[model samples]
Structure formats: C-alpha cells, structure tokens
Target: MASDTASLRPMPAPERALARKRRYRRRLRSRIILSFVIFGFVLTALIASTAVYLRNRVEDQVISAALTKNNNVFAEGFYRNPDAIGVPFEKIQGRQFSTSKLDRVPDAWRALANGVHELTEQDPVTGNERVYRLAVRKDPDYWFFLAYDIAEERESQERLNRALIGSVGIFTLLSALIGWWSAARVMSPVSELARRLQASGDSTQPEPLAPHFPEDEVGQLASALDDYAARLTEVVQRDREFNADVSHELRTPLAVVKGAVELLLSRPDLDEKTRARLLRIQRAEQQCTDLISALLLLSRNERGHGATDVQRVAEQLLDAHRTQLGGKPLALRLEGSRELVVDAPESAVNVALGNLIGNAVKYTTQGEVIVRLLDGAVEVIDSGPGLSAEDAARLFERGYRGTHAEHSLGGGIGLSIVRRLCALYGWRVRVVPGEERGVVATLTFSAGNGTL
Candidate 1:
C-alpha cells in the first residue's frame, strides 16, 4: 500500500529558479482566461453581424418587388375602365398577387387633396404600409392612377425576417457558448500543468504532470517546459557541489591566517620593528577576511533577497554607519516620513556603501561626508577633489582608473564593485560635483517609499 501511494504522488525536479515559482499562478490563470475570452468575443460579434445583414436583405427584397408588381396592375385597371372609379373598391386590384393576400388590395384613396399621393399606397384594413415616389404623371381623362397593394409585401417580409432572426440568434448564442467551452478546455489543463511544474525544483521527487494533456500548442509548450525542468535539476545539483567546494577552499585559508597571526602576537620577545611588521600582516589578513565574508553574504542575499519591505533595511545600514563615524550624529531626511525600500538584496547596498564611504574618508581632508537616504536613493557627499563629468560617467567601471583616483590611495576597483552590485539589484548610480569642490555619489533605488 505504501509503495503504491508513493508512486502515485508526483516527483519534484532538482532545481527551479526562485522567481519563476513566485509568479507562476497569477501568470497562468491570466493566460488561460484571456485566450478563451478573446476568441469567444470575436466569433460572437462576427456571427451576429452576419445574421443581421441576412435578415435585412430578405425583408427588403420581398417588400420592394411586391410594390412594383402591384403598381403595374393598378395602372392597367385604371386605364381600361374609367367608369369604374365609383366601383374602385367593388373589384379590388391585384388581390391574387405574390406578396401579401391580406385586406382588399391596392386602391387610390384620396387624402384631403393638399399633397399628391405617391405611386405606393397603404391599406386602411390591415395597417400594412408601402412607400414609393411617383414614377410618372397621371392621365386625368382615363382616370388612370398607378398605385400598388403594399400590405401583403410588408407582411411577407416580416414573416421571413422573424424566421431568419429566430434561427440566427439561436445559432449565434449556442455557437458562442460552445466555442468558449472548447477554448477553455484547450487552455485549462495546460495552465494547470505549468502551475504544477513551477514547484518542481531540486527535490528528489519530480512533479508529475497529468498524463492526458491536450494535443495543441499548449501541450507542446508544457512538454518542452518539462524537459527544461529536468535539465535544470541537474544544473542545480552541480551548483550545490561547486558551492561546497568554494566554501571549503575559501574559509579554510582565512581561518589559518587568523590562527597564525594570533600565534605571532602570543610571542613575548618581539621588538618594535617585528611588532610593526606583524601588524601590517594582520591588516592584509583582515582584508582577505572581509572579501570572503562579503562574497558569502552576497551569494545568500541574491538567493533570498528581502521582501518588498525596504525601509527597515536602509535604517539598519544607516545605524551601522552612525556607530562607525563616532559621535557625529547622522540626521535622517527622506522626502517623507519613511525610508525608501526597493526590491534588492542587503549585500547590494553594503557593497555600494563600502566603496563610497571608504573612498570619501581616503580623499576628503576636511568635513564629514553626509550620507542621505530618500525615496529611491542613498547618497554620499564628501568635501574632496570634485570629479569632471567625463571622469564621473565612467568611474564605476572595473579597471577604469580615474584622474581623481590617481591622486588618492585608489585602484578604481571600489566603485566597480558598487556598479555591479547595483545592477544585480536593479538600482542605478550617478556621481556629480558637490556644493563645494567635492564629489557626491548617489544611488537611486528602483522604487520609492514615502517621498514627494
């Protein structure tokens, strides 16, 4: 029983990237719904439009032809029997014509004599209406009035229209509903498969997609994603092995250096020269220690970069700076009440700040360098040799030795670190001349907190 149950559950793959999982649910739902809605709307509109056109066409043709035939018959009757004017209704004309057989048939009814009635006429009995402009002048001697029976034409047209509308309306409604269902079926399973595959990252159990997938583009896409996920599992397992190796090689040496330095300090008979040399060695060892530690922190933050909350992290970095700079009070000024937070890792801010502050202290001979945090920003302003626009623009690139850096204890690698970390975290950096002849380096984060 246990073995069968284990086999039924889907297996998870080795390694899915973190971001892909975060957005999978929302993305897949939107895709499936949108596909069905778009196709259904288009089909419904087209069907309705065609139906309307066909109904109108049938109605127009029936009414128009009936009016013409009635007028010809009326003209023939009027000319043949002028004496029958008194008996016009006694023998109604065109009663047996093709269009309508309603009421008594076409007659020239005099309506109060002000306006000449047109060739078309309406029946007093059936309320059926017909309209036409005069086709020719009337011959008074023969009492010939070319008029037509329009009731039957109108009634026939209305019947055909009712039939057409009933049929087309029903068809459009049924087709639209059925098409929407088909579209949903085509997309829903594929959407679900994508959602399931998202959690397939580097576990021993791989995600099992449904065996029955739709045979369409969506199915092909899901299969491709599965293959890609399998490959990614292998890659992540390898990275784990590599990370272990990097950690061992890097940490072991750093530990040995500190141990050796402590041992040297323990010796009691050392003169000032030897003591000074050992101190220098210690500082060099300290540099290496900082590097390895920074690298490890960077790796971790990039893996699980903080949530959307940013103000707290910025405050933390600022508090550390305050402690280091002695009793000089660091005032906080955001455009508003809160600190700016962007989607980024803590190491990104640390690496950028490390370069900025270290460079400021090394170059500035006078006042304190103010670090400002606002919406979308952290800036370091120092009273040092201000840089040219040319120097500022390209300063942060690796191996780019600036003119100002040449005059200080700088190799241009510090700002390069700042640039790279900023890029990784989606922040931007710019350097400008300060209020005095000094340099002000500012980092603008990707988002703002409470700011104007």
Candidate 2:
C-alpha cells in the first residue's frame, strides 16, 4: 500500500509556479529579440537592394552618355582628318578603328549588335585589368569602333557595395543591442510585480502595486492585480468570520449534546436500547466536530500538522461504522503495521480515511472491510462487488455516483473531498480492483518532513 520514493517527493506548488513563470519570461524575451533582428535584417536588405539598383542605373546612364559624346566627337574628327584619329579626352587612353574588315575589332565586340557595350580587357603595357565601353558605327565602306575606359567607375561601384554590406552588418548589430535593452526595460516592471506577489504570499495584507508604475500596460496589469487581491482579501475575511461564527454556534450545542449523552449513559436504570442510542449520538457529535474542524482548515487553505497515528484514526473510523452496521453480518478489521505515524491533524486524517472506509461499508452487504496501514499509505479493501469500468473511471469526479451507488444515499462528494485533501497535502489517492473480489482504495502520504 505504500507509495514509491519518487511519488513521495513532489515539488512544492510555489516552486513549480515560479519555474513556469521563468520559462514564460525567457520565451517572451527570445520572441522580442527575434522579431527585432528579423525586422532589422529585412529592412537593411530592402534599403541595400534599392541602393544597388540606383547605383547600377546611374553608372549605366553616365557610361552611355559618355560613350555617345565620344562617338560623336570621333566621327566629326574622322570626317575632318580621314587619316589621323585622336583620343577625345585624357581618360580615353585606348582608341581603335577598323575600316576594312570586322576582324580588326576585338573578338568580344564582334558578336555585339549596335548600342554601347561594356567589356573588361587586360592592358598590354601595364598588365592591369581595365573596363571599357564600346560604341560601333558602320559607314558605306568602313566600320568605326570607339572604346572608353571605365576602370575608375567599376572601382567606385565595388567600394559602394563594400560600404553597403558593412553598414548592413553594423546596423543589424545595433538593432539587436537596442532590442535587448528594450526587452529588459519592458520586462523590469513585470519582474518587480512578480517579486512583490511572491513576497506577499505569506502576508495577510498585500501592498499596493499600481502606485509603483506609470499608466501603461504594466500599470494596468498591476492595478488589476491589486483589485483582485483586495477582493480576494475581502472574501477570505468573510470566510474566516463565517467559519468562526459557525464554530462558535455549532460547537456549543455539540458540547451540550455530548454532556447530555454522558449524563444519560451514567443512569443505571436506562434500557440497553436507549443507552446504545446515546452512545451513537455521542460518536456522531465527535465525528461532526472533527468534520467541522477539517472543513474549516480546508476553507482556509492551510495544513494542520500534529503527531497523528494512522492505526488509531482507522480504528476509530471502523468502530464508528460498526456502530451503524445495524445487525449486518459484516466484519470491520484493522491490519498491517500499527506503528505507522504521520504529521497531520487527526481531523485531516479522519476526513480522508473515513471517506474510504465509509464508502466501503456503505456499498458492501455482508463482507469484511480491512484497513491496512503500510510504510506511508493506508488501504481500505472491501469485499463488495468490484467496480465497473464506468464507475472506476469517474469514481472520484464530483457529483458522480457509481452504478452500485444509484440506490445509495449520498451526493457522491466524499471521494472528491478526499482528492482535494490529497492535492493540498501533496499526497496521492487511488482506487483499484482487489485481488479476488471487491475494490481497494489507497491513500498514500508524501515522505516529507511529516512522514514516519
């Protein structure tokens, strides 16, 4: 019946919540940084593309205009001289004219049609690469070719391209750094809010959070939290007052009933039937008191720990069930380790274990309901009809009645309460089919500072 060591060590709720928040924050920061980087890269790519297109357009227009001007000047000069063809400008270092055969033109220029064309060739004297623009004209008997050197223009384009690439890299890095700083600035308020909330976990009165921030998204969130906290505090205050009033009003009557039962039990002349009924009444009163205390603790969302013996609580529950058996031929017994103890209030133990035992006794007609205590768990095995698939599936669901419980008297909330208590205390509770016949329910306690 005992739970495994791994099951005994569950993470605390606050720590788990904090870890989840941290993961969310990391994802948020990463998304912000990624968005900024992608935006910067895309914008830089667009601007660089536009700049390259314009630079290429301007370079082509300038080269074309220069080629046309030089071609006109050469034509006029050739028509005037006919024998000597001179360079038009100082930048026009190379000049070539092919009058009779097309073979006199460069091999790269022979395949071109008409308009100006750009080509790269090696200088014969300097052995350096030079770019040139060629303009061709055909007369009746000769072909005129004019070449313009554009090496400096090509060098300028290369430098512009290099500068654009370097700017893109530098701007991208700056954008990433700005994104990081912006994310930090944006998340700082949220981080402070979380810290304040965590620090207020143990406090009865929470500090105002809205006053700490400006009227922005974070401020609205802080204001909302403050409103929720105030409303929750009021609700808790009302719940505490109601629980206190009920305890005061109900416990007094229960104490009087207990005293009256004791007084009646002392009467020697009372009949056996009346005395038995009085004892049942006294037990009922005690059970009610325990239930009230347990319910109050649950409402307060608090755990009350004491040196509680598992066997002792089980025996008491069994005795209570035995009194209500009313001549049913059923055996209620306790088995296994008698020394198993846990650090929980007796009422909490009673509310948890009593529900299992009570359900077992209620459903079973005339067989044994055994309470088995192991290292860190208690099992309630009953020789009732085994649970059906449907019953087992939704057994612990609130307001769900088993097939056998269709005719029973209950709202089907006992197991739900037990489940809530287990979650509150980091315990585990489950139901399974018994070995031969019937069902077994186990309540396993965590091996924390309270387990023995």
Candidate 3:
C-alpha cells in the first residue's frame, strides 16, 4: 500500500561543531604555512644561485690572471734557453709546447684556440687525477703552452657547493618554524573572535566584541558584527510584538465563531443539513486556531512539544474535507495505524499534515485521498494525476504552481509552509510519484528527543 520510505539521522551538536572548527583551522594553517614555505624556497634558490655565479666568476678571473702571469714567466724562461725547455719547470711538473699541435697532451686538450682551458688528467708518477689550467700563447717563432695545477681550487668549489646546499636545508626548516609561529600569532585573535561568535548564539543579548581586539581588520569585523546584532535584535523585537498582536486579534474572532456554532447546534429545530453545516463551521474555526498557533510558532522560530495522536488529527482533517466536498466523487479516508502518537504540539501536526491533506483533496477530482499513519511518519496519498518532473522538482518552492494548477484557486504556498514546518521540527517531508497513478506526500518525523 506504500511506494517507499526513508529515514534521517541527526548528528550530535558538539561533535558537529568540533568537526567544523577543525576543518576551518586546518585550512587556515595550511595556507599560511604553504605561503611562507614557497617564499623561503624562492629566496633561498635566488641567494644560492647568485652566490654560485659570483664564486665561479671570481675563481675564473683569478685563475685567468694567474695563468697569464705564469705564462709570461715561462715564455721568458723559454726564450732564454729554447733547447733546454725542461729546466725551467724543475720544481713543478710543468709541460712546454713549441708548436700549435699538442701531440703529447691528452686528446681532450688537443683543440686549444690560444686561451686558458682547464682539463683533468691522471698523473703517471702519482697515479692520481690532477686538474690543470692550460694557457696557450702564440709567439713569433713558436707556440708556448703552460699547465697550472688547480686541484685545490676544484676541492674548494665542491666544498662551497655542499655548504650552500646544507644552508638551504637549514634555512628551509627555520622558515617552516617561523611560519608556524607567525600563523599562530595571526590566527589567535581570529580564533578568539570565532569562539565569541559561537558563544553569543546561546545568549539573548550579545556583549560587545570590539573592546577585546586591537584596531585592525579583526576589530573592524567585530564592530560590524555589533551593528548587525543590534539590527537583528530590533527586527526580532518587532516580530514578537506583531505575532502577539496577531494571535490576540485572530483567536478572538475564531472563538466567537466556535461559540456561535455551538449555540446553533444546540437547537432542536435545526435540520440535518443545517446541523452538518454548523459542525463544518466549528471544524473550520478549530483549524484556523491551530493554523494561527502553528504560524506564530514558525515566525518565532521556536518549538513546543506535547503528546499528539497522528491518527486522530488525520481523521479530523478527512472529516472536515468530506463536509466541503460538495458533489465531487472524491473519498477522503484515514487508514493504517490507529494509535500512532508523536511528541509534537497538535497545532504543528495539524498545520503540516493539514496542508498535505488539503492539497490532496483539492487536486484529486474523482479518486480517493488516503491519510496513512506509520510508526513515525504520515503519508497523504492522492489518486490525482501523478506529478510531472517539473512539479516534483519545484513542488515545495514558495509561490510555485504545478502543471495542474492552471485554474486552481491557490497561491501555491501550502507545500512551502509544510516544508518550513518540517525543517523547524527536525522532520522530513518529501513528495514522489506513487507506484500506480498518484503522488504520495510523506512526512517522516525525527525519532530524537521530541518523538515518541
């Protein structure tokens, strides 16, 4: 007899709040730390590159000057004795060349264009690799070459590169620590503001927040919040006064109508049709009273719980609709559970379930409108034209009329009011296509503290 059913579970307030705070803090902290890390990386890379470039440039310049000076001394000594060229280099393992062709040198150093060139070669006597800087000079009678040992300079350069890498790593770690500390300092005030904002929700009147913060962005935000709170307080006060006046003014007329109907019904001469009409009037007045109470509760954004019988309310609504059915062939009936009770005010149950029943009666012309009460839910199934896709999608939107509402005398606000009531009472309301050829509107009450 039912299409489907769904249930919802509510999360505990404390856990939800804690999770939200953790997510917010993680995002803020990560952004701050990532920014600082990127800045540190870029700055370190720039400094290291500049240091390496300058070190290489300075070393190249000094080595070139030394090579030129040593080349001159070798050229002078070679000119003194061209035949005994090996005597000038007795203290160092130096090599001399007389022509541009370097047949005795390594193949890697054979192609030289008369400038300083560095090469690494193995020493035959020591069986160790030695780095040498070769300075080639073209003389009038011959081409002279001088080799200078630069293994110490190469070792120094390697040490400098290693030290720069180590410094970069150390500085990156320091930057991460500084970033964490700085982010904590920056977020402390904002966190305090958030804590205060959350605490303010429990109070009717919130304290001023601007005094606790210095004159900065956070302080300005606090001032704005103060202004907003003042405005909201004013609006709430006006709404309370208006709801009070409405309740007083509207209930007086309903009470008068109910009293008049009772007086009329007590007369013995009243016919059966007149008696039925008077009873319908009384039922309508009661419905109006319940509606006013429900609307007031909604406007005030408050909950009032009491023991209410779902089946009884559904029967009352169905009987009332039957009285006003005129000549229509629609049968309004209450089915399913007989004693399903809930922990909500009668007015809320009436307003929310009444809308669904009323809509079913209005839309279904010839078929039946069944009000079925389950364990913690009420389903109003109508054998009207099944809902279209568009109607099902925006059925509960305020002031939205369905495809079948072209000539209906309604503002399309009944389902909207039902949706809001469901939300206020931690209930869920959904309308879907029935199994055969109707629309089923289900209101599932939350099985929390407010439900029986």
**Which pairs in model 3 have colliding backbones?**
none
Ranking by TM-score: 3, 2, 1
Per-residue lDDT tens digits of candidate 2, residues 1-452?
A: 22211112356877999898879777887778777888887899789989999989987998788777777677777778777766647666434455566677767777776668888888899999888888766666555667777788788889989998988888888889988898888778888888888788678899988998899998999899999999999999999999988988999999999899999899999998998899899989988998888887878888888889888889888988888999998999999865878788888888989999999999999889999988888988999987777777787788998889867898999888887778778788888777777888888887874476
Whole-structure CA lDDT of model 1: 0.55
RMSD of 1: 12.9
Error of 3 at 328 (Å): 2.5
Error of 2 at 45 (Å): 3.2
RMSD of 3: 3.5
Question: Which ranges in model 2 have alpha carbons more than 4 Å from their true place?
Answer: 1-11, 27-35, 90-100, 120-132, 138-140, 148-152, 214-221, 268-276, 323-333, 363-368, 382-404, 432-439
Score candidate 2 by lDDT: 0.82
Quote each prediction's TM-score.
0.55, 0.83, 0.88
Model 3 segments beyond 4 Å from truth? Answer: 1-23, 83-93, 100-102, 122-129, 138-141
Determine which window of 10 residues in candidate 3 has minimal summed lDDT: 1-10
